[model samples]
Target: MERLTLSVTIDRPIGYDHHGTIYPINYGYVAGVIGGDGEAQDVYVLTEDDKPLESFTGELIAVVHRGDDVETKWVVTDFDVSYTADEIMATVRFMEQYFKSTIEMVD
Candidate 1:
């Protein structure tokens, strides 16, 4: 099995809102191939205040076997917070950077 791990650190604080409450948050996403096949699976971890809150596993968000590349984009939002696109993009970029740094292997 081929495994990849990516992580990023952000100077800005990160937080999440759930059930009318806001809390510090940390998150990580990982994707990789198995048995040298083209298909891939992904896992997403969401942590609040340094504790695990939720985890989701599913098929890869985007896959390109021929090109030997895969990409995943997650849009996390809190309707109550009303963040703009720029704000969202900033968060996404943070994740992107984190993933780029943390990835251990890709195939």
Candidate 2:
């Protein structure tokens, strides 16, 4: 898959709580991009910075496809780093664990 640059607006920053779960990473959406769920594309921003951000601009690394849902979460990063499927899943498992999902690399 070809990689694309994305500008994400972080609605759920690090430590953000959704019900009882705290977010460990920045979670957001691309303004003009729409997903299968008919909403702005959701994204999980992974970075080594370990700080909350209002927005991020990065390359699309992989996509988290949920078998039972209409939305597919995108994974993006600013660093020149690679992640295995297992590692990606482990990092996003905080919320992804509730869905039947799989990761597909952009490369």
Whose TM-score is greatest here? Answer: 2
lDDT of 2 by residue, 47-88 (tens): 988999999999999999999999999999985778888989
RMSD, candidate 2, Å:
0.8
- Steric clash count of candidate 1: 8
Stretches of candidate 2 exceeding 4 Å from the true structure: none
Cα-based lDDT at residue 69, candidate 1:
31
Superposition error at 65 for model 1 (Å)? 17
| Among all candidates shown, the one with the greatest lDDT | 2
All candidates: TM-score: 0.29, 0.96
Candidate 1 deviant stretches above 4 angstroms: 1-25, 28-52, 55-69, 79-81, 98-107
Inter-residue clash pairs, candidate 1: 5-102, 5-103, 5-104, 6-102, 6-103, 7-98, 7-102, 8-98
TM-score of 2: 0.96
Ten contiguous residues with the weakest lDDT in model 1: 58-67
